[model samples]
Target: MISSVLVANRGEIARRVFRTARRMGIATVAVYSEADADAPHVAEADQAVLIGPAAARESYLVADKIIAAARATGAEAIHPGYGFLSENAAFAEAVIAAGLVWIGPPPAAILAMGLKDAAKALMIEAGVPVTPGYLGEDQSLARLQAEADAIGYPVLIKAVAGGGGKGMRKVDAAAGFAEALASCQREAAASFGDDKVLIEKYVTRPRHIEVQIFGDAHGEVVHLFERDCSLQRRHQKVIEEAPAPGMSAEARAAVTSAAVKAAKAVNYRGAGTVEFIADASEGLRPDRIWFMEMNTRLQVEHPVTEAVTGVDLVEWQFRVASGEPLPLRQDEITLNGHALEARLYAENPAGGFLPSIGVLEHFRMPAGIRVDSAVEEGDEVSPHYDPMIAKLIAHAPTREGASDRLAQACAEVEVWPVKTNAGFLARCLDHADFIAGDVDTGFIGARLDALAATPEPSDEALMVAAAAALGDQDGPATPWRDLTGFRLNAAPETTLRLYLDGRPVLASLPQGDVEADVLITGDEVIVFEAGEAYAFSARAPIADLDEAAGDGQIRSPMPGKVVAVSVSVGDTVTRGQVLMTLEAMKMEHGLTAPFDGEVEALLVSAGDQVSEGVSLARLKAAA
Candidate 1:
């Protein structure tokens, strides 16, 4: 058995690995950068080492620093948790070369499945079904365009080295192919340093279902089952669940068996996920499913698989890394119940899902559920890393029951100041199509406007906020009674002025206590409803409010670099015209004109880093 383990990652990834290490009675080592010096994972580890500065290039991605930390701490092995150096074949090889066990698959297997184009060819040879596509060596734009025409319209151009939805584009027709190809290649080079791409037929209605397969050094491979990660936005998964909702017995058998075969083809060891894209224009069928790519590490959604199978995947990884034989035969793994996992990110769904960065002044997750979190109350959500603060998982005897529980859990979340996607996740889980298992990768995008719109505070919430802003009542007397003056029950109908999200509103309370959880932080009164936070402060209505409007000031929504400037000063633009594009938190956001106006000033240029609320451009109202 491995005596000590060092996790070469940060945030919840490291924390999760440390948890299992402790339970197994093995010592845990944590390596952190300066930005994560006070992180929970660092404090919980048996030994900690500082690797580098805040930038990931200088810290987590530096394999030499990680190896040195492992040696200095007398660590027996290194576990590359999900991201950063987790899938880096060179880093895995380096760990082995330094006389420390590498708790992952062999370097050769990683390279075999690292590129999507090459992996598909290998899977085909292994008798696993793969999606029809063009994976030739030609890098010419004309060649890619020709391939798309042959593949038919609505082709998906994906980076051969891409994952996590980056470096991919969908072209609906021949006219859009060239521009989409350029954008795809640019993103591919920037993200992966590999500009090569492959074109495939894009299923109009695609469901992302992946099989979790595990292997041992003895060449035994078994699958745990399948997970539906179809609920996504912009190619990124938001919610995931196991045993796919509408998967037939035959479909499940086929997908899981193919996954095991793919693993065997690479002589794979430890945890790996074989992702398959299902054409769901009709429904999930064995013939409609095809292999897309393979993730050569433990997936973030592995908890749902564990919940259904009653198996500890981390423990299995440890056993396999120690050169042990398979822990369980193919028949030993049984799917029992249903489980759902929602990523709780520090982001504002209403504000175009922009990443929210701030100190978590008030953070609370619902009780009686599995929560893997990185930050606690008072911890800052820095802009230097992924904005996902935690993952909320729920399990029940049935799929419907699991969905209901997970929705309730999202609604009960209470985080403030720093926004989160809890409300959006709750809405998604409660959506009618989602409940009926009629979902696909385009589900969120199709209904983004509805799901991202911030709901108005309910009357009950308004009353609660009003009462809290009024302060304590005199000796058990209802706060509503005091607001209407000390008059003797004269049909108390006094309206008070309050600001909700900086907008003034007239509020009145009923005679009794409002049934809602309220948090009073400083002068701000916050109320949580359906997983949404409404902050209110009592104050006089602002005069000349229109002066602030129609100013034509385009401010940066969050801290990021200005990737492109599409308009110049004195240019006339219509409302909603994209003026510039800002790259933040690994996503591009287009800043648009709020109204039809002429550009009066361009305050910033391309490549300039801007902070949140900084005015990047301004316009003059059209005469």
Candidate 2:
């Protein structure tokens, strides 16, 4: 057995791997950047090392630093949890060269399936069904356009080396092909360092189903069932489930068998996922589903499979990497109950899913469900990493029951001030279409209005905030502090003015001393109502913040690096014209002109990092 393991990742996945490693009595090692020095994963590990600075390129992505860290710690093996160096074939080879056990598939397997263009060819030779598209080595624009036209309209332009939807675009017609190609190529180069791309037929109604396959050094591979990850936004998965909803027995058998074949063909070992896109325009049929890509490491949604099969995949990885054989045969793995996993992101769904950065003033987990998280109170969510805060997983005897439980769990979330998609996720799990298994890749996009609708703050929350403001958490203070800022020396007013959800709400408070489940922190108060907490600040409404902004100014919404400046000084632009694009939290946000105008001043250039509310450009207002 492996005596020690060093996790070469950060956040929740590292904490998750440490949990299993601790349970097995193995010493856990953690490598962290300066930004993650206070992270939970570092504290949980038996030994820790500082690799580099906060930037991933300077830290986590640097292979030599990781290798040196492992060597100094005398770690027997390294676990590249999910992202970072997990799929880097060269990194795997380097780990092996350093005389460290790489707890992942062989470099040969990663190389075989790392690139989509090459992987598809191998899958085809292995007799696995692949999506029909052009994987030819033609680098000309005319050739790609011709292939798109031949494949018919609405084809997908995807980076050959892409995953996570970073370098993918959907083009509906020839008129948009040129711009789409350029944008796709640019993003591809930025994300994967590869400008090469391939065109595919985009399935309008697709259900993303993937089989969890594991193999050992003995060449025995077994399928651990499948997960339906169709509930997605911006091409990223939001919700995932085990034993895909409404999966026919025959279809399941066919797909799982094909996934196993793909794994065996590459002589795969450890945990891998063979993702397939099923055309649900009609229904899931064996012939309609095709292999999309293969993830050569543990997936983010692996918990659902574990919940159903009662298997600990990380433990399986540890065992396999320790020269162990397959834990169970294909027939031994049986699905028990339905399970659902919802990814909770620190993003505003109502605000078009714009990711937010903040310090978690208060963070509380709900009861009666499993939650995997890495954040706590006072921790900062920087603009340098993925915005996903945690994952909420629920399991029940049936699919409908599992969905209901997951919705309640989301409702019980009590994060304060930091905007989250909890309400949005609750709605997704409870939606009629989602409950009835009538979902496709476009399900969330089609019903986004209802799903993203922000609910009005209830009166209960207002009173609770009022309680906190009155110093009720500390027995209503000596006198009473209310909207008037009257101390306990002065009698407090019955009504308190509070800024709740960006508007003033007069909340009636109890006279004299009062008590409530609340806390006053800084300029804000967190009030607990029915197990969920709401943040409020009781004071005279500050004059409207947006009132100072003049027309025709394009401002950056958040602190980010200016990736592109599309307009120069004196350039005429129309309303809704994109002036600049800001890259924050690994996402690009465009700053557009408010009306038709001429660019008056360009304040920033490409690659300049700017702060929130800073004007990137000023435009002459239209007469």
Candidate 3:
């Protein structure tokens, strides 16, 4: 039996593993970077070890350091909680070589399924259906172009080692095939250190379905059913649920069998996910499903699989690592109802979903739902990691009930100071199309304009703001009286400037009415009358309000090291021109100018570490 285990990852996954391990009487160890010294994962562990600096390359990606931490902590095994080096065959090999049990599939299985082209070949040999594509080893540009032509138009160019849609492109026309291939190759090389790619026939209007499979050392494997992750952004899953909606009995059986075949072919063990793309335009059919990829470790969206199945996947990982056989038979396992999960990110949806970083001054999530988070109130959202604050999951007897409960829970969540996707998620759950289960990968993007639209402040909230401005509370030296300049006889109306959504809004406070006129400069007064004013309060700023706003310059969107600077000082650039690039959370984000302007100053150089909202370049307004 494994007495102690070191989780070789950080953030929510680490916390998640610790929770399960603690319940099973297993001591848990946490490894963290310098930036995560005060992170919640550190607090949740039985022992914490510093791996390295904040950059993932120096910290989580350093397999040797993680191994050393495990050794130092006397951990009997290592649980790689996805991402970083979770699927890295070398890391698994190293852990086994170090005499510590590896709580994942064998290195051979990981190597077999690590590359998409190779995995598809293996799956084909295993009698599993794979999407029609060119998985040949030819690297010549002309050869790929020829293959693309032969495969017909509307083909997908994907990196052999890709996941999360990074080195993938959809070419709708033969004319654009070469350019898309070049772009995909460049990104593939930068992201995965491999530029080898493959082409596949694009499945139009597809639904992403994946099966959860577990294997034991005794050659016993079982399927834990399926998850619908059709709701995506940039090919990254945003929402997921168990027992995919609208799935026919025949289709489910086929997918489950194929998932089992894929795992058995690799002699797999522990938890793994077999992802498939189904042609939903023609409705789900067994023949329409094709293998996408196999995630060799636990997925971030695995909680929903746990919810409906009543299986602790992490506990299973622990048990399977101890050489346990299959605990439950296929006929014994059954789904109960429906469950949904939403990723709550510290990002501003209206601001292009750029990661938001700041101290969570007042973080409060709703009860009666499972919230797996690695941070707490007063925790700082660093740019050194992924901006996901938490994963909120709700389970009910029906999909509609689950969605409705999740929406209500999200509305009651309060995360002040740091902007979040909570409001955006709430809007999505309440969306008519979403409620009716008529959603696709393009749903968020299609309804983005309406989803990101911030609602006007309620009358009650405005009244609270007015009360805060007026100093009505019993206290010494009223600031409102000071603003009125000590007028004795007549109560004077005063104009004051306040910041809202990074812009100035003029508020006029009159003595007679308990409300204020929210005046739009050079426009009209939007009258706001008080309704229920009890639950409203003024929100404090995250940072010092008196600080100058960084010279009105475009800054890095998240905490990251500057990878490149595309523009120089005094360079004339148009609106949306790329100025620089910053990389964080293993993803690259480009910083662009807001409008046509001349670069006035370059504040940061390549390789500089920057925090969120730190100015990278200053742009002078166009004449």
Candidate 4:
């Protein structure tokens, strides 16, 4: 039996595992990078170790450092959380070699399903339905192109060694195949250290569905059911739900049985997920679904499965790692209710959903909601990691009820400074199409314009901000509060001007002069209106003079490392020429030329870390 454990990862997952460990009376150890020395998970652990610097490779990805930290802390087991080295066959083997229990599937199981090509072949031989793809031995560029052409247009270039939507791209036609392949390969190498790729036929109107499966050394493999991860942006899941909506009993049975078959074929152990893609053009059907790949670790959306099945998957991981029998037999497991999860990310949905980074000045989840988060109000959201702030989950007797509850909870979110997708998520939850369960992978992309449309504050909300600015509410009065339309023997109406998301808006006291239900905290105001909350920033002092952005100037949109400076001074460029690539929040953002121009100054270089609004280059307009 394992008495102590060290989580070999960081962020929310670490915190989550620590919670269960504490409840089980097991001592917990946390390993952090330089960037996370003061992180919540580190503080929560009974013992903390600083392994390396901020970059994951220098810290979390270094297997020796992680194992050494575990040994130093006298940890009896190592739990590799999702991402990082969780699915790394070598890392798992090394952990076992160190005489410490590995709280996951065996190393051979990881290798068997590590690569998409190899895993697909294994699944096919196991009599499981597999997607038609080109996973050949020849990784030559010409060979890949030939296979992609045969697979037909609208194909996907995917990295064989990685998951989490990284190193994957969709090619709509033959003309863009080469560029997409090269980009996918570059990302694959940087992320997973394997540039080998596989080509697959992209399912039209796809719905991403995955079955949660578990196994033990006793050869028992049971599934916890399925999750619909169809709501996605750029192949990354934005929202997920358990007991997928509109799923027939036949379809669920087919997917879950297939997932179990795949697991038994590999003699899988512990918690793992078998992912599949279904052609949802006419909704879910048994034969329309095909295998995608298997994730050989705990998934980010495990909570929803737990909510519906009343199973604590992490606890089972601990039990299985200690050589315990399966928690319950396959025939005993049953689904309970419906559950849904929405990921609150630190990003600007309006700004093309670019991941945001900085201090979370006013972070607060809605009261009475299940929130799994690792950051507090004053925590810094560094650019060295994923920008997800938290996962908000809701459980109810029905799917619509769960969706409604989550939507209301998202609307209750109050965050500032570091923008969040809270409002955007709220819109998605209540959208008519989403309510009717008419969802596919392309649902969000197709309705992005309407979903991302900025919400307008009500009249009462505007008055709240105005009243707070004037100090006319239940607070200490400022000297300026008494100066509103001051006139001797004369009555006059006064108005206040404020900026709502950078747009000027006029506000005045209501007819009753009653304060709205709002919370004024210094310069930030949280206005509660119609059961929804709207956060507004105080207008900055107007500048007497402002400089306009010239077409030739290119500035960094977010703070990050300059991964690539593609242009030099005097280089001729076109309207959309990529001058440099800035990597932030683990995604690359391109700084391109505004128009046809010549590079006049290259102010930044590769490897330099820059802040948002930093001038990276200046281009001179062509004569």
Give Cα-based local distance difference scores for all models: 0.88, 0.86, 0.81, 0.86
| Residues forming the 10-long window of minimal summed lDDT in candidate 4 | 482-491
Give candidate 2 misplaced runs (Cα > 4 Å).
466-497, 506-519, 527-535, 544-546, 572-575
Error of 3 at 562 (Å): 4.0
Q: Give the Cα error of residue 105 in candidate 2, in Å.
A: 0.9
Top candidate by TM-score: 1
TM-score-sorted candidate list, best first: 1, 4, 2, 3
Clashes of each: 0, 2, 1, 0
For model 2, how does the per-residue alpha-carbon lDDT over 1-623 read when each residue is reduced to its tens digit? 99999999999999999999999999999999998899888989999999999888789999999999999999999999987889999999999999999999999999999888999999999999998999999979999999999999899998888877777889999999987897778777866678899998999899999999999999899999999999988788999999899899999999999999999999999999999999998789989999999999999999999999999999999999999998898889899999999998988888778887788866777789889997887788877788888999999999989999999888877676677888899889888899999988989999999998766567656655675576554444432122322223233556788886567878876445444445566667766543234667765556655544565566777788887788888899998888887878766677788878899999899999899888788888766
What digit string (tens of lDDT, one per residue) describes model 3 on residues 1-623? 79999999988999999999999999999999999999999998999999999888799999999999999989999999977889999999999999999999999999999999999999999999999989999978899989989998788899998887778888888898876787688668767789999999887777899999999999999999999998887677788888788899999999999999999999999999999999888778999999989999999999999999999999999999998887788887889989999988887777777777888755767899999997898899877677888999999999999998888777766665577777778888889988887766677878888887656566334433444444533344322121212222333666555445445555554555453322121111122221101112223335644235434478666677787788888889998887887777655677888778899999889889887677778887788
Could you report the Cα RMSD, in angstroms, for every candidate shown?
Answer: 3.7, 3.9, 6.4, 4.0
Q: Tens digits of per-residue lDDT for model 4 on 1-623?
A: 68999999988999999999998989999999999998899999999999999999999999999999999999999999999999999999999999999999999999999999999999989999988989998988899989989999889999999798888999998888887887788778878999999999998789999999999989899999999999998788899999999899999999999999999999999999999999999889999999999999999999999999999999999999999998899888898889999998988887777887877656668777689997987788888888888999999999999999999999878665677888889999999999999999999999999887666787767866676665544565333122322222221345878776556788774545553445555554566542234555456645434124465667788888887787789999999888888878878777788889899999988889998888889998888
Model 3 vs. true fold: TM: 0.85
Give lDDT tens digits, candidate 1, residues 549-607. Answer: 66778889888888779899999999999899887766667899988989999999988
Candidate 1 least-lDDT 10 residues: 479-488
Residue 281, candidate 3: C-alpha displacement in angstroms = 0.7
lDDT of 1: 0.88
For model 3, what is the alpha-carbon lDDT of residue 437? 75
